[model samples]
Target: MEFSSNIKKLVMLVNVTNSPTESEAAEDAHQAMLNISIPQTLKYSGVRTQSGTDIECSANETILCDLGNPFKSDQKASLIIIFETSGITLFTEQITSQLQLSTISEQTDLLPVPVTLNVKNTVLTMFSLEKQVMDTSFSGSVIGESAMNSTRDVGSPLEFVFRVQVLGEPLGDLGRLVIDFEWPFAVSNGKWLLYLTEIVIRGQSESHCVPPGKIVNYLNLTLSKEGTKRNKREVESVYPHAEASVTVLTTRKVPQFLDCWRQTALCQSFSCPLSNMSTQVEVRVRARLWNSTLLEDYAKALRVEVKGKATLRLLTDKPAIKMENHTREFTVNVDPVLGEEKPYEVPLWIIIVAAVAGILLLGIISLILWKCGFFRRASRREMYEAKSQKAEIKIQPSETERLTEEF
Candidate 1:
């Protein structure tokens, strides 16, 4: 709807028609006015001529104007009427007022016939409408980050946290909040490197007076992967626990083959009439990592670069809230520890075979030495007997020689 000051200031174009004699035309022109019947609800301000000159006026009283002299030939004039009131019109309400030419001049036969006019139907809806606005701020980061540096082990869990805060009471209706995430690594040879697993949402209002479950009544959260909705049943089941002390959780395995970029999005909407209160919403997204990824591994650490953006929109036809997209970029240092090595051990059968071989070689060497007399020793009794026998034989031979000499 359009707004203008003319809505309060009324303008009328007046015309007079009569065929008067030369004597009447020669007479002096006189001042005139139109009797106005305005509604009692209206508080009339002063009036003005077409040239913006002030004219005395009263509430529900006469509107003094300068219509051209009726005693002369046909002529025209304009009257500017200004008024004010406190009443406001709704969608289709209107106001009406009646205006009639003064009877004093009409009784004196100044004009040929009576002139009557009415103010056109006027509606002041544009003046009553107020622009809807809300002040908000958005931010996102890795949960355990320190100076923009984060760490995640290979095949371990990673989390991303996002928050939105309202500085004042929201005059406009709340719409969906969209957060888009693009991972640093992608699918490797049709295998998933990393994918979203679960999403958690928490809220607080009234300067943190309201807790997670109570604020669930005002929130509607959803999860999406590659532009497709996920966890419909899980998200719906949380509504029954609006008053419970539970946070909203939606769990789903992001489809790996659907997209290579691992693009995921989360959306949240809210109800209205949260009066004179501050609202804060937090979102935590958890993902699983695989050993194989396209990220660069340096010095036993895989450094992955991640980026994401968050946007908040109002469910209004004409929005006055000005919000900027929340953006974040960070690096994750992943340490994939390698396994330890063990010592080699010999088998029991090999030990037994080596022992048997050594025993057999010793036995064979002893038998060969005995056969070659290297280990044999003669008896000492046999050597002494042989020496005694030799001495007896020498004495017996000398006796035989003595017998021969006696003969």
Candidate 2:
């Protein structure tokens, strides 16, 4: 009888019966044997079969071995086992068995996990307004009116804080992280300007791991203005009046980390100079992440991007002046004080009047002096009388002298 069956362990049994006619030690001993060969690729731990080599087996013997999977994910291979029997048979016969082994089970591949980003809070620390006032007549009194008004300057040493959080698998040591700040109305009319002075970034604890000869958790930031574009229509607009340039603020290489594995991140701080503007401003904040080992080229392949927005408003307070139509009259008696109250500016009419009065007083003084003979010249008749009197005196003196001589 011939039989074949599939089992974990193989066992072959052979029975040989000698006829009674073969007495005493006349019959030689009968022996049965088998040969087995297995494929080389099927060799696994705890199995004793050599690939492409024949293994001798005796009848009524069983062989046991374990079949372990050795193939990788999605791989295909074949296992062939061949067996041949010989040595003893009722009739001349040959037996051969072939089996095919294949490994279909595979491992799963690892995929990148998605990350989440969020914006926490936006605070406007400082605000100011620029206004131009025009004087207008109201009730015979001058009142000021706002000609143009806009937001002007923001207080200096200002700070803007941003928070980042990880949502997915832990990102390994990041090579680079970038945060870009863009002001939408930077190019609007009124020549708005925004200046950033300093920037700081903090990373999570797990992200502090640095590879050999490499620094992890570092950030690279840049500040620049958008390329200039001419907009004739915007320049002619009445509200803005002219086209302006956009401001871009970038931070220096600040160390930062996002531990997706641990779901944590650091807060970012930006110190800016006094920023001024005349219109509503929109700021766009963009954040990007890069692998620490790959650097720039691999950044795109394994990068994360998140965006946020903030709006700043300028508040102003101006005094209002008004004049009343009705008035009341009152009488007062005052005691003079030692100190004089002086006007800040003398009137032009008062200056002219004072100059004319001074000239008139000088002329009057000169006329009075002239009438008092202070500047008079001598008369011709008076001069002639004086000369006649002097001559008669001289003649009398001479006559007296002659009489004395005759006596």
Candidate 3:
């Protein structure tokens, strides 16, 4: 319906020829209100007399009236009066008020509250309608929240509705063209006054963790518009608990992957005191996502020179001291950290093989000497040299004796 507010104020007068006879056709208009309920709260008694208009409807929409008489019609009614005002119209508005969680059944989710209204109507003379030609349109947030008793709660969705009557009380017929209706509702806790908007429950799922090592942080959740329409797309664009958050968990400080000991931790345990290790080393471990620029530079070998601190020890509540991923340049002169066991190591078989080979080599050498005639070559050479020397001495002596006889 094409609805207008100020234009309906018939201010100008028009000239007419004669008064027309009034027809007895009892033309009637029925108006209904859309609702917004707060969980854990009851509608206030002060809401019934509030005023409002069809701000969302079209021109054909007859002005909303508290079930009362056809109060008034201005010059614009010429068009509105003729049409068969039909089709359902939905009304919605937010009510603000204090909430009562005590009376509401304790629930993990939100609850809804109920409200009621009694529109009145009666045939009256033109004078009878002047007082309130139409109920005035009050802006949303008109209703207020009030205290509620949370003591009693039965199992239910807290699903209830409301209208223009005294909430939580009996409604009676009005003196005009309106019907009286009552709404029953339940309510829950919210940050605002009765949460004029539907409660948006956004949360992550439940999770568990084991003892020792690694961060257990991540969740899957769903958001629902409970009671009435509410969401993040347009409803709560600026709300917190949005994407700007990330969770962190730690059973024990993660040893750095770079250090000599921690590097072996994934496959086997190593002797590294976890107590003295940098608590911040986990940052370095997880910072792969951050891609530290200096590390990236070194990784790219972009420049031979870059100043950076590779590792920092983080003392934790644990008894051991150790850290990892320290730059090769950063050496911790810590006491030789020992685990309950020093890496159960195996002896290198090569050493054993070399010792066995040395024993076999010495035996081989002794055998060779025994078989090749130890001193045989030396004895033969001595015999041959002695015979040659004896022959030489006799020849020389005989030559000297012969020369002396001749003289």
Candidate 4:
């Protein structure tokens, strides 16, 4: 009863990139490469496309988006565009110094190798291969690889590549960080189902170094896989989930934003801070699916909406400015047109009850008056009494009214 070579492996990868250091032997690029491994498999893992946002292009990762179906047979995964800028300093130190980065270049393979094993099937969930080079910030996945219905091959060597940027500056109080990741790889086509997850950060470690110290790697390659699929799909399952990565780009900053002046106001108000600065941000949201439910569920991992909301806090010099949550909602349905969610005041049950009570009270008062000659003729005695009451009230109503008149 022991493990065999046929055993598959599951790994979790969190690419730590572009970390700042306080010492001379802080970290280096080559040292960062040694960290990201299967641990059990020892497969060298790193991401090349994650390093330089624009250093190279036409990457090996292929995202086959079929307008409707992202995971078309031709393209098993969707395109995850990554842009991370870093300040890499080739050095080394100790501890989880700067996150170790992989030196091996990326052998871009968009199509996962298909296997026919009875192992659980695998699907593309969080699929993005990019990280900022160093201390600077960009965007990357949070979970290494989160899936719905899938499992790993148990002992498979899954190679991963992520870029690392080293910061020449000193870290103040933050140090020794772990990028928790989940490796989602399968050895069988039957085990593959849908989706992935991960979280990344620009970190500095204290354990990496070479001769003077030790080779500290700035970037890390993580391998991970969960041996389970969430749900199964059929033809008519309500609606298949889908995701469209529509990156919305703009030149406007928050605080000072573009008021809908349309044709006229579009040219009128371009204020300070926002005037000379060109800022960019990513708004990851969920959109409606357009194809098979099986495919839609897979794509929902990436079905984020495209909303345009930049910050104006950068206008002032305040160390770190808090960005006001600028969120938008859009729901795509069976109908061709997409519907956006507006801040709506839905009628609550309490309000409905209050309205009903008011209506009932008004109805009761009307009924009473109608039955009491409100519209019919009044009797002679009743008319005389009414006149007397009015006269008595006019002459001297109450002590309160008399006091008011005296005043």
Cα-based TM-score, every candidate = 0.29, 0.19, 0.16, 0.16
Cα deviation of 108 in candidate 2 (Å)?
49
In terms of lDDT, which candidate is strongest? 1
Give the CA lDDT, 0 to 100, for residue 77 in model 4: 15
Off by over 4 Å in 4: 1-147, 150-348, 364-372, 375-407
Candidate 2 weakest lDDT stretch, 10 residues: 134-143
RMSD of 4: 33.1
Reference-based TM-score, model 4: 0.16
RMSD for all candidates, in order, please: 21.6, 31.1, 31.4, 33.1
TM-score result, candidate 2: 0.19
Task: Give a tens-digit lDDT track for model 3, residues 1-407.
Answer: 12111112111111111112264322222232112322121211112221232122122112221222221222011111112112111111121222111112122322333323221111111101111111100011111122111101100011111111111111112111111111001111111100111111111221121112321111111212222222335222321121212223212222222222322111211111222111111111000010111122112221121111222122233222112222212111111111111122335686689899999999999889979887355578889999999878843458778899899
Task: Sort by lDDT, best first.
Answer: 1, 2, 4, 3
- lDDT by residue for model 4 over 79-104, one digit each (tens)? 22232212111111111111222333
Winner by TM-score: 1
lDDT of 2 by residue, 1-407 (tens): 23111112323222112222333322222221222233221221222233322333222222222122232222222223223322212121233323222223321221222212121111112221111111110011111113212111111112234333222212122111222322211112222112222333334321111222211112222322221222445222311311223322222232222221222222222222112211122122221111111121111222221111222221222111111111111111111111111113456687789999999999999999999989898899999999998878843457778999999
- Candidate 1 per-residue C-alpha lDDT over 1-407 given as tens digits, one digit per residue, 9 for 90 to 100: 23122344433343433345665653333444555665544556655555343334454354444443332333333455555644322121235556655433433543333333322222111100011111111111112112211122223455555555553333233333334444433333443344444545555432212222333212121322322122435323321112323233222222122122344222122222223323556655455443334222211222232333333333323332233444443333333222101112456687789999999999999999999999988789988999899878843458778899899
For all candidates in order, the CA lDDT equals: 0.38, 0.26, 0.21, 0.24
Question: Model 4, 290: alpha-carbon shift in Å?
Answer: 14
Q: Lowest summed-lDDT stretch of 10 residues in model 1?
A: 123-132
| Better model by TM-score: candidate 2 vs candidate 3 | 2
